[model samples]
Target: MQNRGWLVFTLGVVGTLLALIGIFTVMEGQGLIQPRTIGLIFFFGTVALYAVVGLMVSARKVSDYYVAGRDIPAFYNGMAGAANWMSAASVIGMAGTIYLLGYDGLAYIMGWTGGYVLLALLIAPYVRKMRAYTVPDFMATRYEGNVARSVSVFAALAMNIVYLIPQFMGVGMIASRFLGLPFAWGVFVALAVILLTTFSGGMRGVTWVSVAQYLILLVAYLVPLVILSVRLTGNPIPWLAYGKALEQIDAYEVVHGMTRYVQPFTNMSRLNTLGLIFCLMVGTVGLPHVLTRFYTVKSVRDSRISVGWCLLFIILVYISAPAKAALVRNDIYQNLVGTPINQLPAWMDTWGKQGLVKVNDINGDGVLQFNELTLHADMIVVGAPEIAGMPYTVSSLIGAGGMAAAVSTSLGLLMVLAAGVAHDIYKKMINPNASEGVVLFWSRAVLVIVAVLCALAALTRPALIVQMVAWAFSIAAASFFPAVFLGIWWRRANAQGAVAGMITGLVVTIGYIILSHFYKIQFFGILTINAGLFGVPANFLVTYIVSMLTAEPSKEVQELVTELRFPRATRLIGEEG
Candidate 1:
């Protein structure tokens, strides 16, 4: 009910923002205004709007702060989930990979989108039925051991921080590029927006803000594609127009005597592709921030329906990403491939200044050959509007969308991490008699501290955006997925087995990733495979064998699992000693 008013206000504000941006574009194009100035206005304007909303819906009660009082409807929860799941990696990274790798890049789309199906079937319903505020709470309660909960809390914090810092960096980078500000200043802006929105309302505010973000980002991504599609093939649907563009690209590649862009296994091996897919699919079910979304809905039924809606929203962008990539690739080949370096389009000059696109006369031929140019894939989506000769405002919109994706996911991850500390460990183990006011105060305090720390870490310039994400998912898949899946379905899964499984999966995956990424070492050549590949199986084997070797979970724990597994019978909330 509270969201209805917020929804109406958001619609009006977003519409006004879009209209103003269009006007600014017209002015800049006609030489009446500067595009960078317009960009600054739009960037700060949108972020300020979110800050205002956060303050407006700020919560007082612990229930409202933590899980929005568990009152969110199925549809809105789905939208928020979609927004939370589709982080900067999904918005910027996927299209960029598709642009660079062609057929090989489709793996990201397949793995990420397909993971929702697994969430719908395997995890969402049962997790929601548990009625816990955080994943560690469920893991601790289900296993009947605070030790298990403590392990989960540490794991959740590690994974989420690794994930969260990159998003913070992304937000900073996007703002810096668009407004021509220092990267640190852009990071400060991001920190301000995050603290304002998240600190004000907690989950209650974040859920609605996520809905607004999803709408803004989806529109920003789609508008340019539709325009480019119509220009290339007289079709407004980008994916459908991709068919026409693909034929043209293939012909152009033949004329240029280049490798076909549509060929499979061109960028990565078949084994790596399939391994990546498996990691992503299994990884989705385990992400603390993502799985936490199921807790916001009112019932188990809502949780299931929400996953369906989340997938629907995600597919809209997933299917379009490849098509957008193909069109951009074709556009470059058709127009810029044979042009002399100095005579290339303005976009080339613009992005080249940023080091995103490089051109060299490798053969001393003075012309920009297809093979002579190297592009960073992140440019594909961010530079697409400019590549298509759209107004500068469209490019600005893309930047805003990228920021939205980064901040929304960061907000969600930050919340779960705070809950892991304040609720799971602090209240549960450190001070069981802590009052609601004390718990709420510490939770908000932890939330703000986490945001600030992540923002500062973002300035440290960590790993590549997409690579850091892969590590996070691999960790989740290796550590959390096996324990979560087996604990609910296998009655013999004792607390000892669950804890041991988590440790095995986590150590194997993280250790392999460290060796492969940092030391460039591939132990026995197996570490070169997806890190989750080894970790997941190790978890299953160790957990199953250990549980079989040990005693079953206590009768009460077994009965609790049965109740959660089948929602037709009894209900439990909070937890029993």
Candidate 2:
């Protein structure tokens, strides 16, 4: 702990750099200068921010840098985690998804909100009490062996790489849209900027940076939606006003109103819609960066506070997303959806030029239908900024906000990336006695390597918004979440069982994802997100089956469990073993 000398200076510099980036991004978007100037601003802003933040916050002690001193207030940790988890998908994509899919998009809304609750109630406290700087640390002790830790490390690492793909792609897309640059350049620029900031801040800088970014994401999504909602319906409560089916209203009167358009929601059923929502809600608790935040808090109770805050921030965006989606869907249909194809709004015509807005004019009435917005389902939010008719400044602000969301989530993943390399693989097995300096160096190196690789993946447009991260969430749920929950709650859950469960889940998920990516399979009529619909069940079955066959853990493992249960009696001590 004494080795962490750079902590304070890093925070000051990173904070300053973020503010500058925000200012420059806004100014550049306002047309205050050239496109290249905006690029320069983002580049300088990220570099200076990371350099100062990194050099100041983390010294040679990996634990301090990785876990934020393990004395952070639950509220602060929760706030940071919220920013980290929201990402580009939440801030910029979810509402758009709903707009494209009608009420069916409620799946993301409920799932994200429900996830934090699950984390607070089911996973947070015991893991925080285990006192490991990372999730794999808990697995090692619960299993009473290195095998569980190894398995967990690999799982956590793989899931994170999967997680990072969409965010980089988002930032790139956003930059390309706002900065008037190529998508590849935007991706490279964001990657370089994040690599600099994350390599230095480690986890410590990330916590503060994330908190600031959370504030940005919430404001970005809510402010524009609020304005759009209030402008359309004299009411600020858009959710209630907009959430109705087109048939539920007086279609004739609404058609004549000339103010608000109607969305046809009669086709969306509750049962199927709710099922997907349930999967997301429960699956959310199992996400890696999400659960890792519990380790940053000072105590078990603090962990609960963090979950609450996370839920609260998410709600701010969650409520607004639906509101925005409904309003946009109606607004588009009322004004432009039915208009002559060439008579579409300037925004659509311009965006269509960029391949972002593709109107099908299905009836050849030159009218755009709700189904037309589903061209890819990912462009809803990005297209929303312009549809609201906000000035370029506000649109740029939203773009900046989206970038902040992407960056915040990216940093959190990068920290986990650093930890997987430094703590799990390196300290646990590679060279148990590697000096603090060497560990710290490797941490920075890991950040650089992972950021670049993720940047490469982003360039390829590898996966769409929800699908890319959704697969990662499913993995977390089936594998890590089950093991962590059962490890703490079930006394008979030995290292062997946990290992077997993780291996089963990991292998199944990889195979499923690969098959979906390289091969294809259809189940009944509806093809699955991947082959993994089968894997989740297989995971739970194998976990208990293996635990039954294996001998109970030695008394030492039981003793460790007891200690974990009594979080305060023995502070979650790390194994210096």
Candidate 3:
């Protein structure tokens, strides 16, 4: 890498960190402000300002904006990409969602992580070899027809819209409930923040902003668990407390004295355990946004480091969550449940009125059951200060962390969505002769349009973060995983086969989800299944069958594939270097 690259990347990161400091120092509504409002504003405001700084520093070069001049380091790139891939959804939503779902939620964790392996082993290095700016660039180069181009465009669109919704919805949920503000206002605030980062700087600005997001997300999740774990289990490490947590979830019926909607997941059978983990882990490799992270890495090795760093950061929250969930559940049962209704913790009454928590005390037991608390699980973090008797200031800081995590991720997704529109479509397929400046203009322009669309989707909001995220993962698994993996390892793969496979897999997976979710099917006097259940096999089978039947790839595509598989050629590499 050249000094020019180093100067740009270092300057970029330091600038972002300074901006974060400045933003934090200036925060005014620290006490009266709800977590949602402060989080949404500060995160968006601070990062947007970073983007503006980044744009000013590098606006002279289109290449700098697109890929940081292609000199991003393996280690830092790994960190940046990991943070980019993980968002508010992972930091704020995953644990709470997992706590409620138990073993079922492991599927999301596995699916998200697994998608990156597919990127490293199958698609990323080869895509890098293609020397293209985005994922669609690979599709365009691989397939002979506009068919590949069209699929790439639609895939990027599908991945972006579905992924963006949860982010907006979450911000809306946090703002309206936490701040006592209208949900639409939360959506608008987040939109403004996202626009500041993406519209100003494109990928370069977004990258540094994500680094700040990662810090906020990790700290917010880690601190509470550390405090709870040491107090409850006499063990500072929460990941090791899975047995205790599972035992808690298992004993909910006894603890809360409510036997309804309480199943002993701890006693899950062997087959059930295998099925749950397998589905989640294998599905991880299929997510589009995760794969997109690899595009930012400078090399395949760097891509691998990014995944390793990602897993390291991800495990911080993943391991602690079950323990925290269990501890919180126990705390609720021991101190709050079975108490006089008004005697419940002050935090409960406060957040409960905000719809963050609710109590029926249906058994006349004067206790809130584990089942009774699932609806309120999302607010546990925000309510932790009052529940555990922490200082009010600390609680506000956590809120700030959560909002920052969410905004940073939304910004990353926002940038990716913009690139798909501008670089993938406007410059690549639509105008082959488009100048670098035209590309830069279209990229930022598209960034603005997508930001508005995502904010609107947040208005309706979804039922929960996990559901929307799961749906998106299922879509990616069916459409991308099979095709990309086969393309890399198999010799027989061709444009016809790859195209056939993607369409077949995507349609089967997405169509089934829509049908099963929206309406059930009637077939020959027998009712059959939810969509993802049947869709997975359909995607693989189509990819395999189509690849087998279609002619092998063109000579040029095959040679490119060979080159991608081999060590970098000194002659060619030096020439480029």
* Top-scoring candidate (TM-score): 1
326-413: candidate 2 lDDT, tens digit per residue? 6766675566555666666687777767777777756666555554553345566656656777645456556767888888888888
**Which pairs clash in the backbone of model 1?**
none
Highest-scoring model, lDDT: 1
Cα-based lDDT at residue 490, candidate 2: 80
lDDT of 3: 0.62
| Model 2: how far residue 475 lies from native, Å | 1.5
Compose the digit string of candidate 1's lDDT tens values, residues 25-49: 7798789988887777768877887
Q: How well does each candidate superpose onto the true structure, as a TM-score?
A: 0.95, 0.86, 0.83
Task: Compare candidates 1 and 3 on lDDT and give the better one.
Answer: 1
Residue 519 of model 2: what lDDT? Answer: 72
Candidates 1 and 3 compared by TM-score, better number = 1
